[model samples]
Structure formats: structure tokens, C-alpha cells
Target: MFKKIVMFLYVMNLAFVGNAFAAGQDREDGLPGMPYRTPTDKEFRVCADPENLPYSNQKGEGFENKIAEVLAKDLGKELTYEFWLDRQGYLRNTINAQRCDVIIGMGSDVDTLRTSKPYYRSGYVFVYRKSSNYNIKDWNSEDLRKGIIGIVGESPPTIPLRDNDLMANARPYRLQRDLNLPPGHMIDDLVAGKIDVAIIWGPLGGYYAKKAKEPLVVVPLPEFKSERNSFDTLKGKAEFNISLAVRKKDKDRMEMIQGALDRNQSKILKILDDYGIPHVPVVLSDKIGN
Candidate 1:
């Protein structure tokens, strides 16, 4: 599950064709331009999945898109995107390839890229119809086992489900899929009565629950310890701090991006609220697990 989450953060592929920039120009600060560095002084180039929403998309309807707009405006730069599919080779082909300068949303703990201070924190959530009146507050609730629970295959929430002996009641969905298709199908199934409940990422759960035809309940899973013998000693943190990311060596660009985030913090928080994105107070840390 940990590996899958990390891969999801690291391997989003974007498919875009834009004018390539010249590399190796000397900067006014007298530092040599890093290879494949975009002209950051004039543009806020972002690498994003063109179809992943609640996060980003080609239509600029996602919260990440909205946040990117705020940052770009605050920085006085034109916002441009390198649209890609969120799949294996994403970081390799886009940001790592120097096709863009930043990824609007990335887990702060991702070691492969230099990440900015987290803007917000979020986690997995339990989504059920408000009509069900289940009031599920944690993984141990007996109501969870009494109904069909939809979960992303190998997601962190599955650990608790297994620990509570609820696997038999679970319906696992694909963790990765074709980017051309819209997301939030699990919530769709829950709304249609195909599943009684869904344990999904907080952002997806909150966004889709709000858009569902009937009212839905979204409950965040708090941090806990894993009970599986193999992972007994490990702490299972459902929540993760989210931040912008740049190439590992691009400290200057990262500082600039951080400045933009700091300046427009309120606007970004408003965007999250408007989208119904479930989040908690930011914890400025790069460590993923203890």
C-alpha cells in the first residue's frame, strides 16, 4: 500500500507538445542555467495530469488548477501546463525531463523531487450515504463490516480493514486506470447503492460526496498503528502533507514557488473549501513515516 501511494505520487505521466526551451543560458545572478530549466522568470510552468480531478485536469476545473492560478497570479507569471497522463513515467517524462518546472500537488515526503512546505494535509476517508445513519468514526466500527465497503486496491485504508477482519465485506477498485476516463467511480457506486460505503482518498471522497445526488457522509481516518504482524511495528499514517515539487537540485525555483504559496495561502485554502476537499492543519515536515 505504501509503495502504491508513493508510485502514485512519483509516476504521473503528462502528454503535451509545447515549444522546447533553450538550455544552459547564464542567469543575471551569475549562476549557470541548469539543463532543461524553463524560463521561470517569465512563466509558471506546471506538469499536471490532464484528466485527474480534485487535483488537476485539462479544463482547469480541479483545485490544483485553481491553486496554480493563484500562485501564478501572485508571482506575476503566465501559467502554462504540460498535460500528462497520471501513470508510470510521469515524473520521468515531465518535470524530471524538464518539460515543466513544478508539480502543483505532491506528497512532501517524496524524496526524488525537492518539495515546498506543505500547504495542507489530507488522508483517507470513509464515505457513506447520510441516509444510512451509520456514524462510523473509525475502522473498528461494526457497521463497516455489516455493509459492502468499496476501497481502492492496496490503499492505506485497507490495512485497517484487514486488521478489523472486514476484507470479506470489501470491494476493491483499481488504483490506477486510463486517464481519459473521469475519476470518482467508487463514490458513484456508493451513490447508486451498489456499495454501502467507500473508503477512499480524502480529496476524492469529499469532492464526489458533495456532488452525489443524495447527501453523503465523509469521515477522515486518523493516524494509527498497523496491527498486521508484518507491519506491527510501523505507524500507519493515513494523512499526508501535500506540497509543490521541483527537480531535486532546483532550490532557487523551489524557493520562488514557496514564496508564491506563502503569499496566496488564504486563496488556496478557499479553493480547497470551495471544492469540498477534506484537509487538516498543515504540518511542515518531510518525513513520511516514523
Candidate 2:
């Protein structure tokens, strides 16, 4: 009888071991059978520009660069950067090609690109001289009848700009010193009085408005929607969210990347705020693109 009892116990132990192994296998082979493992001892890749300021650079001084650092720390991995000029083709050639795993500081609304939830949002604003009596209450206020507004060629402005019939009057001009230009430079011309007003991205608008040493007010554009910003991966890449991209495929490394982002979202935001990263949206509106 004692031997029989011992045999029963041994059988139970074997059963438990089999179940454990099955569960582990299931986790490793998630539904659709893609292996999802938490990565460790890996370097996660981020795409960045070598010279772009306020965004990213090799020195890792840009806002996105700092955010990457925080994310890497949270993931328990090292941060690796791939330098690409901030151009239309950068994402495809670098990020999509697996040269980098993520594109930080991307517009969250770009439907063609996949994005994580927005950590910050801001509206397009026109920066103008403080001395000007531009009572531009929002994007589509009637007060704009008094002045000419500058905008970048083929850039997105809030609804009022799109509907207000000002595109005909607002002239497109080149403002950035670099070939990879940002729309905010129109505001630079506005401060210099090259143009009366400039529709600009919130961060750059906020940054240069202060730097010009000119009196400027960042008036919120009504009907002007806040552009949600986030990091990007390839569209429909289901595992892209949690996986780390290496030049070669390594399942364990991917797990580490996912763990890092999950663990560090809050800390990343705080670091961004400390540097005046300018991501948090002060307002929320339900209006869709007009």
C-alpha cells in the first residue's frame, strides 16, 4: 500500500510538470504563433537625425533622444541610434528596413504609419509680434482679416486655415537652414516681420518664439486640431509593438524592448517635461479634420 501511494504521488508530479511546460510553450508562441519573449541584454534601435535639434542628434541632446534613453533603461537594454536625415523617405529606408526599430516624435495622426497612444498633443499656432494687434483668438478667428499669415508649402494647418480661403493669400517660403526643413520657420519670418503671421507646429513655435527675443504670443487656433504625436512602427506589424528590431531576428531581444516601454511610459513623460519637451496637450476637442 505504501508503494502504491508513492507511485500515485510520482504520477501527480509528472502531470504538473507537463502542464507547466505547455503553459510556457503557449506564452512563447502567442496566438498566431509569433514568439513573444521579454528581451534582455540587447540594444534597442531608434531612428534619429544627426543634426536635428529639439528632436534628435548624435550627442543625444534632443528631446526624443532623451526619451529613447529613458525607454532603454526601462527595457533593461542599451539604446542604439541609426542616423537618417529627417526626410519623407527616412522612415521607409531606415525604420521599415529594420535599420532602426522606432521613430520617436512622429505625428500620431499619420494613418499610413502605425503609432502608439499619444503622450502629448498640441495645436498649430501662428507666432506673431506681440506689438501687433492680432487678437487671433484661435485658428479661425475673424481677427485674421487684418494680417497676412505665412505657412509652409503643403503643410497641415487647423480647420479654419483649410476653410478660411487664406491659402491663396498665405505665401509659402523656405525658412530652415537645413534641407530637411520644418514648418515652424514661417514663424521665424513672422518675428522678423518678413510675414505678418506664421502657422507653426507647437513645439517649434513655442521654442523659436522665445528665442527671437521678440514679443510674441502663441494664440491657440480654434478649429485647429491638436496633432497627436507618438512613436511609430510599420503599419500592421502586430509584433512590432513589443518586439525589438535587430539587424537580425532574435525573439528574446524583442521581449526586452516591449518590457521597457511598458515599464517606463510615465518616467519618459516626466523626463520630457523636465527638458520642456512640449508634448502635453493643454486642451482636448472632438473635432475631426475638416
Candidate 3:
């Protein structure tokens, strides 16, 4: 898939990852849960990617997990999850399958499932080892014209890479690969001096940029400083709104979940800060029909 962000966000329906729930619960049709309803018990059920760090993981170490914690505590509900490996068919298998009632870090724009008001927004970014002293601020910078650029192969970022004529030195990586394998393929290469900068999804880029063996610098593409829609030309490369997702027709639950998000926002923001998530808020274009 050339548009890897599509795979990461929409397809991230989730992977075979996360804490396991007991399989003995009774179901009307031998499924995980019923579709289109909130839990009757005191649980906030989440559909999660088991291995996506800085987001959700089995150990509950990721920021999304922290957000879930804030949510459960605020709503006076216990936290639980329906784990699914992030891959194609994830949506059909988890939330859509009614295995869980919510997806904690989904893009607000995902049309398959109903999404809450955006809790946060972020975009793709350029990450390079600071020791390399790369000073690129935008895709058109002359500083970027001379180095190896990394990206999820064939993604929307490639559109700008081509437009800016930076594809000559570009490197590509897979969007879907072995789950248990080592992570951070692009930033890993950047840190190893294999590439000058890696254009990656903002959250993972910011998290890994800080952890690179050498100090690393992260520059938000199009910079969330400008209009959040700066990359609209490339169709969703630069920024996107993130929120919780519930099955279609789940408006009642959506409002309840959105209320939790709206109330405990500060606590949720603190959790994102603790994980080094690059938080960007979305700005709408009511005039342009966004």
C-alpha cells in the first residue's frame, strides 16, 4: 500500500497484541460481545493493538492505555480490552465484530466506525539524529536535497517527496511486517546514519526521536504551527485528528465516551506528555466544508 498512513491509522484496526480477557464469558452467538451497545458492567472496554508502543500494549505502558486509565477512573468504570493484532481485517474483527466497544487512539476521520470529538491531533514528521546536524525544517529545504530520506514505502509522504524532487535519495520500509520483530525500522536507520531523516507518523517519530541512541531532532512536516490542513494537497500526510471509535449507530455510547474525554482532558494530556506524544489540535475549515 503506497498510502501507508492509511494502513497505520485506518488499518491499525489493530494487530495480534494486548492483555487477554477471559474467553469464558457467555455470548448469544459465541462471539466476543454484542454489537452496538455499551457494557452493562462497570467496564470500559477497549479494542487495542497489543504491540503498538506509545499507544497501547499488553503491559498497559503506552499513552493510549494511560488515556484509558484516565477514562475509566473518570467514568467510574474498570478498564478492559479485546486484543487484536494490527493488520488488514482488524476493523472487521474487533470493534466492528463487537469484541470491544471502543478504539482509544483512532483518527476522528475514520468513516467505518463512529469517532468521538478529537482528543488530539498529530502529523508526519522528519526525524534525524541531532549529531548529524541536519537542519531541514520543511520538505523544500535545500538541506534535505542532499540526504537519504526515509518513509513508510509508497506512502502519502512520497507525494511530497516527488513534488519536491527528493525521491532520488529516498528509502522505503514496509507498513506491515512481523509483529514480534524489532520496531522503529525507519528511525532506527536514521539513528544508524543510514538515512539523513525519516518522515514518520508524528507520535511514533516523536517518541523514538527522543530515544535514539544519539540525540535526535523532530520537525513536524508542514509544521502543525501552520494550518493543520497544510498537507491537504497530499491528502492526509501532514496532520489528522485522533479520537475514540465506536461502532456505527453507537451515538449514545459515543456521547458518554466523548464526555469522559472532554472532562478528563487535562489528565489525558498529561499522560500524552509523559509518553512524549506529539500532540497537535485540529482546526476545521467550516468555510471549505471540512
Query: All predictions: root-mean-square deviation over Cα?
Result: 7.0, 17.9, 6.7
RMSD of 3: 6.7
Off by over 4 Å in 3: 1-4, 7-39, 223-236, 286-290
lDDT scores in order = 0.72, 0.49, 0.66
**Lowest-lDDT window of 10 residues in candidate 2?**
1-10
lDDT tens readout by residue for model 1, 230-252: 64434455787777878778888
lDDT of 2 by residue, 237-275 (tens): 100011112222333443454466567777766765655
- Model 3: worst 10 consecutive residues (lDDT sum): 16-25
115: Cα error in model 3, Å: 0.7
lDDT of 1 at 233: 31
lDDT comparing candidate 1 with the true structure? 0.72
The TM-score between candidate 1 and the true structure equals 0.84
For each candidate, what TM-score against the reference? 0.84, 0.63, 0.81
Q: Sort by lDDT, best first: what order?
A: 1, 3, 2
